[model samples]
Target: MGEEENISVVVATPLVRSQVVTLALLFLAGIVNFLDRSALSIANGPIRQQLHLSATSMGALLSAFSLAYGFAQLPIGPLLDRAGAQRMLGAGLALWSTATALTGAVLGIRSFLALRVLLGLGEAPFFPASLRIVREEFVPQQRGRAIATINISTTLGQGIAPPLLTLLLLRAGWRAMFAMIGGVGLLLAAAWLLLLRRESSVRTPPAPLAETFAGWAALFRVPAIWGLMLGFGGVNYTSWFFIAWLPAYLQTSRGISIKTSGWLAALPFLAGSLGMLLSGVLADRRVRGGAVVARVHRSQVIVGMVLSALSTLLAIRAASLAVAMACICGALLFIHFAGTSAWGYVQAASPRALVATVGSIQNFGSFMIASAAPLLTGWILDRTHAFAGSFLLCAVVALCGAASYILLVKDSLPLSEA
Candidate 1:
């Protein structure tokens, strides 16, 4: 009887078992995304030595990735609406993976910058494709959990990249690490082509490309949505900047050994992974329970981001390594949770048919702004030789994200155009 009841509940829910596999693929793909992003960080030591780069140059490389990644967002949504997730994302994965491997062969900052730009171009479609998949594959109420599960990639990849890639760097050098990641991407892309192609059909069964673009009209008119975008953009700035430069900072300012820095970097990412899974469950329950779902559901993430911002400041201020580590962990927890909410907002605001387009633009804005943060921060560090000031810059960015959410977009779900 109990088994039957459980089956009934599962049956009634939009999270079909088949769809779970689809989400799992999405999650794994996301893991691949971050691992690719972290290739530079994991290999920073050797790359820096090989290229003899200044912090500003390193920062420019990261900025180039963001600049390309940001603009790439524009076309992705429209294409996802037209071509479907399997083909668009599969092609994107191939492009970015190849770009990552190419990074290993680059001779200088200009080549490195060019490769990163290409990498961004290939990576541009990921979130939009995922958004389309979830909307077509899962129910609205179930999206946060599915999105959360997909988010595990961020937690898992970021967590593993620091330590795992570090080991590869130690064993084979940084250039080799890029090759390793690229190889993994090739394998995953093949797997996606074979196993996940079946799931892509649902994302855009009969949806017209024109209809998807038309939906953006509503998005542009929505003030609250802008608030959400601005807030999340702030969070992304801090999180992405830290991701881009933290390794160099640890190596130069914290006086940590290379292997040790990898382990230390793993701490925040690990905390963030746990936070992603936890916040997803919590947000779902609160939303279903009859509370003001909009304000409260988003609050789970907003509050997390706010806390993350505060911890970043604390991390920058700490005099001791232990204190700094503690604060970094604190900030990381919020970053992951904030993602849970930010992505959740995308799930909510986007109509079932137009989700990919909405998600693409939103994330595009975040990354567009993000392109500058790393470059600016790296330049500041190079010029000033002060880690605290760079981190202070980090704190301010996160605070901007928190304020945008609080003051402007305070809803959990988008208004349906009935």
Candidate 2:
């Protein structure tokens, strides 16, 4: 072969293997994204000490990220509508990954807060885009499995973050830990850029910003969507609380060592993953059986929320570590149950053409308030030195989340062509 022929053969190798399938790359990207978000929870102890942050300051830092995350949804949906998920997601991945690496360099709470805000902005498009992918690629009956499978990556990533970071923190320290997360992100993002195709994000006539805003406004008119969002927000509070403060709680409240804390903290998420899978599978069954779309969604979310609330309450009172882990897992399973329903609402509620817009708004509303849960829980912990109040509050909010979906949105909305 000619010299050029040899080079062409090597170049073709990437086409053959460097780029994998679309769904596989997207899944890995989601995994890396969650890993970055959950890393803070894993490194909470060291970061708190290194910066001398108070509960409120720490809470503020956590809240800052949510603020960006929540608010970004307001506009990102429309942007995705115009630009498409593939490009938007690729850009977001690069932005957030770099921010994760930069987090290791902050010397004070201010810079850390800034970094988190930026991180939130970068990460905001991830779930929306993922949901878009599921909606576009999977058939109606298949979406639950696809969403659940993608959600699995979230739990798996979060489950892995603590144990993995715990190992890194012990050897290289927390700065190195953040840097390592950045490296993982780079690899994932490269995979995404190389492998993922544009089939899902193909563009056409744009949804006018005025009408997009108007479509979002329709959410306000419908008490059901509002209630669903409120309930979803409540669920977020509990989940994020676990992500942000569980380690600190274990270290201070339970007197568990960091190593054991990593293991313990991971347990619930593992359970949550199972719950996620079960809920999706069950939901698919319901849809296949000809259950009303809204009712199936309601049933799934309600089951999860009720389970989560009870499990959380049990977790608070449990005397033994094994009991607590068990309780937490039960709650996690319930939590995942609501998760599929919540996304299902987004899929069902939105105008088909503007599915991304509706989904984004659903998430934006929920996360806007949900984003505060971590910081709010942190503040409560710092003041009272216990998670009981925060967890209880979260429980109440979760109940509200269930009620919103069950009572408010049970009557379906009339769909308009986008």
Candidate 3:
């Protein structure tokens, strides 16, 4: 072949083959990650019956995982930057998977709570590591789709977990369900190691202690980071509310059967998956249209958050179950539409070197706020014996998130310079 032909072939080879392989592995890993975490939520009713726990106590149990996950984010960024995503993620998958399996052995609330904490610690590296990998593998222009693609695994896991696990729970029991999900995670971990053997990030030498501290300090100096953090925090409140409580809500509040509730609860997350994919496409087109990266991202987030808030309010006031599900689905769709842009904003704002750090910081703040959702919702339900107030709280938080994107995070300059 001629020189130009030869060059084209070489350019095309690594981009397609390696990128696809890496993303596939990461995507599958993400699905398994969420499946394991969501198992408890799926089986919440059964577990509560067996353990004789109240909503307040169950909320605490759920918070155990989130608290640990949120706290782990504080240190996970530096660990990813120093150790690279490959080892960190592989080890995390193995550890969390093992924790998930062992959850089947828990004899009481205390042991289950401890296992949940372990699960959080093990899974903490996932998103930060994934973000770092995406930054390394994809070009800036393509990053939105790449981010969205991996994120869809989240919705898939959430969407599938309810019905699938409910079936497992009905047939085999919750313990068996945990063991099965955990085994899937372990298999995925091994696959992740094998599939990416040729794919590893070059580990940079650790910075001096003072410099490392300063880098983290610099992150806090950026107002956009804080804005993104707060904005996304509100988004998480909406998401975690559904993730943690939807099945129970349908079963108790809507008077739906557990089996049907499982299927119905999956609808919102399925819609979210679609929204994520569409948002990524729209974000890329906006960038191609000469919009600044920050503006493109913030615009999507602001619009989605506002619509999500409105939809959430409508869901609360929805006249019937069908109407309510439709409204809730719309809310989730818009939340995820903004969710895609939220990560895109993080990537666009941070320099390549600090993608993991920025992502972890965002995760930390988001989870910290999200951690409260289940507990607060439980508390609200206990007090009011209703979901109207709980759904309203989600709407208000989402509106705040929209305001943060519009007013606090300026789109003019990248976060590195801010």
The C-alpha lDDT values of all candidates are 0.76, 0.74, 0.83
Measured by lDDT, the strongest candidate is 3
lDDT string for model 2 (1-418, tens) is 0000011111111222322265566677777887888888788777778888777777788888888998998788777766678778888998999999988888887788888988999998888887776666655666677788878778878788778888888889989888889877877787677667444533445544325566656546656557756878867777787777777777887789998888888888888788878878887776666665556766788878987988888888889778877887787778877886778756655555566766677778888778778877877887898888987887787777777777766535544422
TM-scores for every candidate against the unseen true structure: 0.91, 0.90, 0.93
Best by TM-score: 3
Give the per-residue lDDT of model 1 (tens digit) for 39-118. 88777767777889877777888888888988888777777776768778888898999998877788888888889999
Q: Cα deviation in Å at residue 59, candidate 1?
A: 0.2
267-369: candidate 3 lDDT, tens digit per residue: 9999999989988988777666666676677789999999999999998878899999999999999999998888887767665566687788888888888
Clash pairs, candidate 2, are: 231-401
What's the CA RMSD for each of the models?
Answer: 4.6, 8.7, 4.9
Clash pairs for candidate 3: none
Q: What is the lDDT of residue 341 in candidate 2?
A: 73
Which residue pairs of candidate 1 clash?
294-412, 348-414
Which model is ahead, 2 or 3, in terms of TM-score?
A: 3
Model 1's number of clashes is 2
